[model samples]
Target: MIVLSEESQRTSGKDAQNMNITAGKAVAESVRTTLGPKGMDKMLVDSGGSVVVTNDGVTILKEMDIDHPAANMIVEVSETQEDEVGDGTTSAVVVAGELLDQAEELLDQDIHATTLAQGYRQAAEKAKEILEEDAIEVTEDDRETLVEIAQTAMTGKGAENSKDLLADLVVDAVLAVKDEDGIDTENVSVEKVVGSSIDQSELVEGVIVDKERVDENMPYAVEDANVALFDGAIEVKETEIDAEVNVTDPDQLQQFLDQEEEQLREMVDHLVDIGADVVFVGDGIDDMAQHYLAQEGILAVRRAKSDDLKRLARATGGRVVSNLEDIESDDLGFAGSVAQKDVGGDERIFVEDVEEAKSVTLILRGGTEHVVDEIERAIDDSLGVVRTTLLDGQVLPGGGAPEAELALQLRDFADSVGGREQLAVEAFADALEVIPRTLAENAGLDPIDSLVDLRSRHDGGEFGAGLDAYTGDVIDMEAEGVVEPLRVKTQAIESATEAAVMILRIDDVIAAGDLKGGGSDDDGDEPAGGPGGAGGMGGMGGMGGMGGAM
Candidate 1:
């Protein structure tokens, strides 16, 4: 059992919130270096001692079993990115972290937390603008680049030879779906089913065929056929009430048996008028219905499961099932003839109705089940990414590119908004500085020196003043308009700063008892038979500051 006191409640809440924010920022920063082309790698070890090395932000966050609420929120950011864009999860997180780091300075200078949050939002708006300015329209030549980009993104996402094969597949799929307006990703969809192999591979316009023959003598295909796959039994057979009872004495049972024969005959006559060329039954058919189907030239199949009936409905684009009593045009799907043949050590079924085919099955071959699974995953991710990109347009750089530029632009904008708010605005600019600083750190360079270099090289004037350790020469970044990938670095900066400021702003922690007491009319009251309340709820008396260092 657990008991909470007012003081303890107050202490724990603040400490926990702060711990979460601080630890989360650190985690975000750790992954920042892995952004962009020059990004570094992270080697992670799981509880089972399994090892993984990758710079992928989503993978990194998921693998690291962090226990901070604030940090988890950052993870949620990546999840959102993945769900919404199919990519750039790392970018969003990194930007949020950097924004948080920037906010921390303002917090230190006594700027309100709410004010810092507002400033960060403004800065984000500016950064988005920079991204828009950098956007370029994709063209014919750019398709290969885009393919390479898509392929690169898909690598290790699980396809073998994804570098070439996956890229080609995407291009082919896109071309197949393209119209005057461009690729129609929404209309071109794919579904996979697991079954024994078929012929090598082929495309058909209509859906594939899958229905068993009801009668052994029924023809495989009906030319220009309209098919109906039904759920109800077609047999005229009925189990009559006159069937003999199991009770002892054979004489009493013999009298009841005579009535059953009469009822079975009437059932047979009713089925003949339904006009069913073939009647598929979901269960065993009675002998009477079987005999009627044979005499009336009606094909009868029995023992189909309800699931198979539903599949048949979808396959033929038919309507729902009706009772055996009412069968009409509205309740039936089209009927067709299908041919099955052995090809390449597998059974292949072909259905050719009048006009063109609407569906095709692509037989993807793989050496092992795992390999196939991976390939399928890659295909799915690739398809999803393509669809998302087509819907949303191109992605911004993964490392802090446009965002760093945007930060600088916002700083200039802040200079004009003079007042106490300007101080907050400057603090906001300082918070934004973390993006570039983080980018520099991840690049294995000095943050202070990088900032100096960035400023000196800012043209509209002169250049060159930094020492290169290799050549002992001066280097300039501004003249080149050089900025690292904004996505990765900005994510780190925003996540870190947001986390840090959130930790610092926490002033109170309330416990169950505290809430209970606060809710009561009395100003104070001691709980009966409970453990003594400790003002230091987190058990860290005077150690509250440690929360910010997480």
Candidate 2:
């Protein structure tokens, strides 16, 4: 209509649905290959020439600069999964995409979008119940089970070759931070050092400050050191308002300078009086203060991060004093040894052997930057899963066992539902099989063959049946030490179903302006915007290989 703006464009009915579904599915396919232990990685490079080589689903999706509305929704699924469990981001997105695929098929059969959405919602609720029923109960006190959970999460990741070592460290770190309130993963900090291999990573009894002593004249190490943490600077404070000092004589100017020095000296004196041999300053330390600190034989680190200060307080059983005047003897934390060591040609401060430290750090060593980075990501995911397992108090068999089990149960559920919605439910059941199928496909196994094998096993009441990607065999995932936090699967199913249902119910798409159509330069084909190279979603022009991920 002439009344409409020139830039506004709209597509209704089937065309709109297909265009949306196609974009969403394409986004899913982009990250599909990077799933499972056998999955490949995607190297994402930005316009700034920064490169990220990771198989992690959320990382890949986040790096990609997608603009398509439908495609962006798929990315949200990954984000939500990551936020909830810090694991299974890929699985969540993949499941959502597959759900859309299934919905498309049902739509082709003349099943209304409302019917599909309703069935998907029902199936999602039932899936969570099935997951809960099949889950194995776990507790925070179960160390062995927790270790296995950590190892399973790290499986097939970059650190898998040395997962045994890292898993032990992760489990220990998580357990160390676990209190009556539950595990606070933030209490566990990871410090990366390039030189040693991944297996060389160790759980530090205390914090590692990636900083050196403020002065070289100070002692490199202290035995049974008492630590002091300050949120304020050790420098002389200036007047809040601008004021001109009337110094009529040179002696008066010298007196003003001496007063500033006295202030800095007093701050250092307070630490010495409190028997503090080490100081971590959140803000800058004045040059004079450094001299005083070194003169007092105290190992002081300036510009320490606030987080490090908090962890230091936890490790040392000390307080982070905001003011020098307020500091007391009890404000000091303890470390068996605080030393500055040269690591990989760089100096770092280590606060080690804190007695019964609630805060612990993991020094992750690797051969190179990329290696260390991948290790950090792997351990991060592992820690998250282990912590989540402790929090949820339940877990499910991994390696697609939960999906396989859920699919079998849903079929039985679909049989009980009446009306045309039953077909939607059945289709949802088939969609759940995509996980196991993709797992087999990524491992170079026959998808159909694996599906049949899984279905046959589940038909015989083997609820724990799953694909062992390494061997291309169907086996008991739990017995094989392949388990995942129950929240991971539950959240993935629920989030995916909601996303899929939302995308499915959209029967119309309207842009702010008369949107141009997306086209291919090679053959000038519009595969997505509208039917057969027509006008529609032009803003999605770069989405085909968007973010350089696809």
Most accurate candidate by TM-score: 2
Assess each prediction's global lDDT (C-alpha) against the native: 0.47, 0.84
Per-residue lDDT tens digits of candidate 1, residues 304-380? 56654554444455544545655565554554654543433454344334232222223344444434444554454
TM-score of 2: 0.94
Please provide, for model 2 over 441-516, each residue's C-alpha lDDT reduced to its tens digit, 9 standing for 90 to 100. 9999999999999999988998888999989889998888888999999899988888888888888888896433
Give the TM-score of each candidate. 0.54, 0.94
lDDT accuracy of residue 31 in candidate 2? 82
TM-score of 1: 0.54
Candidate 2: pairs in clash: 7-513, 7-514, 8-513, 8-514
Worst 10 contiguous positions by lDDT, candidate 2: 529-538
